[model samples]
Target: MAEAVARTSYGRLVARLARRWGDLSRAEDALSDAFERALRSWPGSGLPDQPEAWLLKTAHRRLIDGARQSGVQARAEPEIERLLDELTERDDPDALPDERLGLMLACAHPDLDPTLHTPLMLQAVLGLDAARIGAAFLISPAAMGQRLSRGKARLRERGARFDLPGKDELAARITPVLDAIYAAYGTGWDEIGASESRVRGLVGEALYLSRLLTELAPEIADVWGLYALIAHCEARTPARRDAEGRFIPLSEQDPQLWDAALISQAENALRRSLKLAPPARYALEASIQSVHAERRVTAETNWLAAAALYDAMIRHAPSLGALTARACAHGEAFGAERALDSLEKLQGQASEYQPYWAALAHWSARAGRREDAARAYDRAIVLSADPAVRVYLVKSRGALLR
Candidate 1:
């Protein structure tokens, strides 16, 4: 029962209640109260045969009671009332389960402030904590307490329709929605270091949105590109961190730990993306990931091939970040000398980060250019304070001495 409800969309649940009760505010309050009651009552009752229905009934009662007490007439839309009655009659919670997730997407629409939209989605759709949301946004935990309510009210004021958008309309909004999913994955992938639980939460959320979007818009290449990129990237999740909970670079990671299932799916998606009229960043990144993933050994990696991919990547999406990735790819494909040449092109790109210098230092030391490696390492040491990176520099300097 818990699993069923867990799989079901809380977004749909809230939207249904609001639509039926004719008051979003009242619907949310009643739902919260019902959930609280469920927690208190479930353990003693040994769980319900139909927990979702039970919760819905409890929320319904709360809504009716609150409406009567407040002297508010039942002013629900005629269509909404009809839908509510139909929902009331349906014995199966699974009948329209996917609607819940759709509600989540609608609530997180671009019309809302990005900062507030994510929090509201986390709360109403994902059931995330205020503290977590606050940390994700780098704010006071208390600030998130009413953010969902406020965001929802703003949505209500704008008459945000709960119904899913038409195909073209949905495709128009795909960019932000897809960005949200990618942001979630990065969140999860970076979590132990930043917002750990949230990182996982966002990964699941991304996949959920991907599945939802692809199902609705099967012909959309961007959506397929997103799913492919994520699928490719997630294959390395297990190898990303070690059993000791330390970061492992892709080159040094234990390839044995990668999830083959994700790789297989990624390959299929990559093919699908390639067949589309034009390739985008997602498709390009997925191809790059595939190159690394298909390698038999670190030495066997097609760095030159990867460099070419990154070169194309920068053209598709030019940024400092892209420059950095391309620089690393050059280091892999060409000799340290050529890679250093490539990186030198970005002398002032990120004067603060020094990824180029540090990488150049490692490459120089490995290529037996002690003096050059030491100089590059010194530059990196001055610019960056990351302990692991410092260790890498120190180790490079040591290797030069050896």
Candidate 2:
């Protein structure tokens, strides 16, 4: 119950508290305290009728106590007074205004390091932990924790506003906001059924943010592009596994299981993005997804088109994921031998990325490099967090032995 509340209401609670208290770190600390209190008290008192309201009221009190105890009451008098004013209005936590977007933008403020923006938004807006955000960025949890602490302190020191920025400022901070949303979605998408990855629930939150962005910034092409890309991916979730819960790669999945409505929505968003601007990073990615969406009607994926979009994506972003995906797409479009050559160039950078090893194993097997395929498959399986994916890799490896 607490976990579910944390997954759903944590961001809303934090956003409200941060705006009222004018301190992101304190907001988070107070909320953490509220959750701890709930854990200790809920078991004995039975579940509260309104968990979010309960948590909010408790956290509000915590903020007041902390401010008074730390000699911050005078410095934070106005915020504290506002908190007290809000204390009487805590009957319906759901009625509290959602300031998550404002909070996210604040985290993306230019004063903060650009690289830290995504991690900060992931933590502040989606309630993701440093460990989970670190996993997404390939940083150590301890190091990520330190970085996040510094980021919060920096935000406070710089006095980043908790309100929405002006149009020009919004544009400046919007890129990292989009990146953070995509990163959050990717983290959740990858962790599907992995028990240790509790943040898998964040996928819905990411989608919610994307939808909100499309409404808030209708003129921004990248926002629609991201929405389209995410919707396209979500549309295929039903087909990603077989009846027995075995993993199914995109090429082999039954397109009949794909959500046509979502594909249509994605296509419409992609069209909007293209009309607004040339295909940039997210736009290029959405185009790739659009090509895959075509497979539902054409009954075949256009690897050449996907490969071309990936090449274009590299020109824009050149992210390891894009590069690795491009290699796999080229392998499908050209030949396994050619694909293996493309992938070999990225071995140094691909060592820790599971998709790279999986693609390498597939192309190696296609190229009839039995030993190399076996080794790559072993590594891919070892790195895979999804049990179904590991099972698929094991089966693929067993086929080599036969």
Candidate 3:
């Protein structure tokens, strides 16, 4: 129960506190202190009827105490007192306006280094520690920690506000926000049903943020596209694994188990996005997923259509992940030899990329290069972070040996 509440509420709680205090670091520290107090006190006192309220009051007091101790309260005492009074007047514990979306936008503020936007969002808005964000980005935790600290300092020095941008300024800031949300979703999607609850929480949080973005910026085509992409992927979650908890590749998933409502909602959003603008990366990606979703009704996967979408995606984004996915799609639509050629060109560039190894393993097996397939699978299993993915790779390699 504590774990679930922490997972669901921690980000929002921190974001609200940060907004009120105008100090992200202090907000985090106060909330951490409050949670620790709860852990120590809740066992004997029994759980409070309003845990979030209790947390907020405790964290607010901690912030007030800290400010007084630092002697900074002299100038800000009136504002601080007002905020405390506002908190006390709230009837519903969870009724705080979701400030996380605002915090996310602030983290992706254009004033900061562009490269740090997604990392900062992952840390500040999603509650991922620097170490976890570093692992995702293939950076050392120390480097990520320094980067986050520097980013926060820059925001503070510039007096960044935790408010959504105006319409005139929003477009310039949209890309980083979209990227951060996509990164969050990808992290969760990789670990679904893999016995990692924290990672799984990212799925819901990403979806929540995406939905909020769509509502906040209804006219933005990519917002709808991103939501559609996430929805399409999520629609297949019900059939992603079997009773034994083994991974089920998309092709082998039971279509009957797919959620019809989510698929309908995804298609609606995809259509709306396509109607609004020329293709963007998110729309293109959603189009590819839309094609995959069609397999349930058509009784056949459209490899050629998917390959075409991948080609478009690569031309637009040119990411290593996109290239690797395109190689697999090309293999499905063309032949193993052609896919192998594409994968070979990426050998040096994508050496550290897990999907590259996984793609190589699959294409190599299809091309009847058993030894090469085994070697690639070994590399892939070693690099994969998700235990389920590692197990699946191991099983694939065993099949080749047999």
Candidate 4:
């Protein structure tokens, strides 16, 4: 409920804070104080008649208090003070939504560490709870709490300005925001736990942020392309695994589980992305998903074509994730030998190299090499920290025991 209200009323909330206090810092101070008031008063009061109005009212009052304490107008920033003074003062009043656009720019600060920046945006601006945020990253809630605290302190020390970046710089900065969200989605999608809320939330938030970016720069194809990539991934999320929280390879997933509506939306997003000429990294990734999407069923999937798509991707981005995805395809199509040859070069590239060894285990089992399978499975079990990897261990060792 809090997240919904925050999302719905974000622009207005941001604006009123700026209007009352001028600039981002005091506005955030006023808003945070108002939030504290909400926490203290709302439970008993049963929510004011108009929550947005109540929040705006509380924010103004807090701004006034802050000004009194600071011995200056909270609206003291000269240019905006006049705008502030022109407003009528009253309890539970309504004002235009805040400039969430500007606030997004502020939140996407290049100077701030990218690691904490996305979570900070989720916490401060979107009002997501720590559990949800932590779940997004596949981390313990305690770890998330500590991380967010450290991030907030760093942001404070840097004293990031409440301003937008120039076009090129803004384009560069937006990538990290999207990257963090993508990282969250990746971990959460694989996580074998009941708490999948964070993954869903972060994926939703990432797409939202990308849309916001597109509005700010319609010419930025990468933004729309990113939207396509995430949307495509999200379209598959509900069916990515099954009821038991096990990893279900896409080949084995029921086609009916694929969300047709999301697929259609993703297709449109991909086309919208092409409007900017040569496609970017996300477009290529989406293109790969598109190949999978275009397939009528798993057997009909173009593994060779998919592998080629990944090869192009590697030439451009050269990440271990891309390399691993291709290796999985190789293992599925030709045999384990081909996959093993492909995975060997990626030893130092990934810390979680267990997936590669797991692939080897699968191939060893397929080749009926019991000893090789057991040894590879042992290495895989050691490398894997995630529970899902245990399934490979069981299958491989079971082959030997049989």
Candidate 5:
């Protein structure tokens, strides 16, 4: 229970401190000291009535002590005292604003390098370590660490405040913010755990953050669309693995295990997004997922409809993942041969991409090109980092050889 609370509340605590101190690194250091104190005191004194508030109060004192030790100017002492007074006066921990949203906006600031936005957000908001984020971004751990350090340094040097953007500036920052949320969700989605609980925790954090964003910006169509998209995918969580803990492909997943409530929520969110103006990429993707979700009642996939939606999505988004999904949809709607032809056009471009090889293997197998299928599967298995996915690919290749 302590671990769970720590996972969920750490970001909020850090965000609150970062806002108050106006120094992300210093805030983190103070919090780290507070946690160490908790580790030692909690085991002896028993758990505090309110762990979060206890941590906050401890962190507040640590910050002040550090300031004094560093010989902070007398001019700032009164301000620090005021902050301390406020902390002491607050009885309800729940009253604290979820400053994590503001921190996310700060991480995705337009002034920062665009490429660093998602990685920095993942680290600062979700507490993902550099190695995990490095895997997501396909960078070396050393490089990822250096990049994160540099991004934080830049924010400090620029005196970037941990605050949400004003109405006038909010629109421009929306894309990066949304992208960072999805990137976090994707990391959770692909994670392979000994049990589903670990994966669920990360995915749940991402969903929580997305929901928070929607509440903050309810009028944004893409925000609703993103919420719907994640909800739709999350609805299928139970069916993604079997009783024996092996991975199950979407097509083979038992519909009965899907979460009906989540699907309903997804549908409602998608409807709300559709009511708004200008269709966005996320909305289009949600629409596609909606069609898949329909199989729960209809007992069949509408491949033709999905193919059309993918075509539209490609026109609007044009991502490699979208293109790969489109090819799979085409294979279902049209035929494996045509899908192979389309995938061939992307050969050199997507050669190193795991999904590309996996798709090629599937299509080749369907087209009766046994040798090509085996080769493609071999490549996919070699490139896949997720143990479950790698195992699945190996089993698939073995079946092909048999």
Candidate 6:
């Protein structure tokens, strides 16, 4: 019960506490203390009838205690007095005002480093640890941890407002919020774990944030396009692994297992985004998914359409991922030799990237370069973390040996 509350309500609780205490770092510390106490006490006392409320109350007390110990109680008296009054008036924890959006915006404040915005939001709003977030951003865990700590300190120093930005400021702040959520979703997509947080992952959390963004910023085309992209990817998740749990790449997945309703929702979202403006990076990516989704009814993948969408997306945001994807799509639509040539050009830039090597292996095999294919497969397998993907790669490499 305590664990579940922490997972679902951590952000809401932290947001409220930070708003009351006027300190993000302190709020997090107090909440962490509350959770630790709960773990020790709950096992003995059974359980609190209102776990979230109990947590909020306990953390609030901790904040007051900390303030008094630090000899700042007099200076913090006004905020404390306001908090005391508000706590008296609010009986239900569920009625606690949700300030998560404001908190997210503050984490993405204009004055902070733009690059740190997403990482900060991932840590503060989502409760993702630095190691996980660092993996997503390709930063060292220690470096990411230092960056997040510095971000919070910067927020405190700047006295970043914990309120919704004005209409004019909304557009400027939202991009990083979207980026953070997408990064979390990507982390969830590739990972499978035994821990509760890991097993639950950020996929559902990301989807919730995506839906909230659409409701909050209906005019933003990128917001809707991102939603469509995530939904389309999620719709096909059930087919990404076989019954035996081996990895199944997208092209070979059984469309019958795909969620029709999710596909429909994604298509509607894509339409809404395209109607608002021309196709951008995410919109083009969603269009590629839409083309892949057509195989459900059409029973044939249109590599040509997918290739064209990839080409357009590269023009908009020539990210390494997009470039690598373009090479794959172009190879499928054109020829394996052409794909190998394109991937070769990315050699120095993509030397450490696992997907590049994986794609190289695939194209190498198709191009009848057995030795090069085997070598690429070896590199891909070494770089891969997922057991299922490693298994699949091993199988693919074994076939080449035959």
List the global CA lDDT of all models.
Answer: 0.67, 0.83, 0.81, 0.65, 0.81, 0.81
Clashing pairs in 3: none
1-402: candidate 1 lDDT, tens digit per residue? 444464454556676676554445666777778778877787788777657667777787776666667766556434444655776678786565444434555567667877665566556656666787676666677877777677777777776666556767766766666666666565333111233344454666667656565665667677778888788777787886567555566777777788888888888877887887377887887788888778634536788888998888888787665676787788777767776677678777656556666676777776777898898878877765345445545665777776
Regions more than 4 Å wrong, model 5: 1-5, 42-54, 111-115, 128-147, 187-201, 368-374, 386-402
Q: Clashing residue pairs, candidate 6?
A: none
Candidate with maximal TM-score: 5
From the highest TM-score down, the ranking of the candidates is 5, 6, 1, 4, 3, 2
Flag clash pairs in model 2. none
| Global fold similarity of model 3 (TM-score) | 0.76
Each prediction's TM-score versus the true structure: 0.80, 0.76, 0.76, 0.79, 0.84, 0.81
Model 4 score (lDDT): 0.65
For residues 1-402, could you state the per-residue lDDT of candidate 6 as single tens digits? 578778888888888887776678888889999999999999899887768778887898888887778887668767776776676566676777677888888887878888887778777776778898776666799999999899899999998778766766886777778777776676434222112234235667677778777876888888899999889888987997788877888878899899999999999999999999898877888899899899999999899998988888988888777788889999999999889888998998987777888899999999999999999999988887777888888999999978
TM-score of 5: 0.84
What tens digits encode model 5's per-residue C-alpha lDDT throughout 262-312?
999999989989998566888999999999999999999999999999999
Off by over 4 Å in 2: 1-21, 28-98, 109-119, 126-150, 187-201
Candidate 6, residue 51: how far the Cα is off, in Å: 6.6
Residue 143: error of model 2 in Å?
Answer: 8.8
Q: What TM-score does prediction 6 earn?
A: 0.81
Q: Which candidate model has the greater TM-score, 1 or 2?
A: 1
lDDT: which candidate is best?
A: 2
lDDT of 6: 0.81
**Candidate 6 error regions (>4 Å):** 33-58, 68-80, 90-96, 109-119, 128-147, 187-201
- Total clashes in model 6, counting residue pairs 3 or more apart in sequence or in different chains: 0
Better of 3 and 6 by TM-score: 6
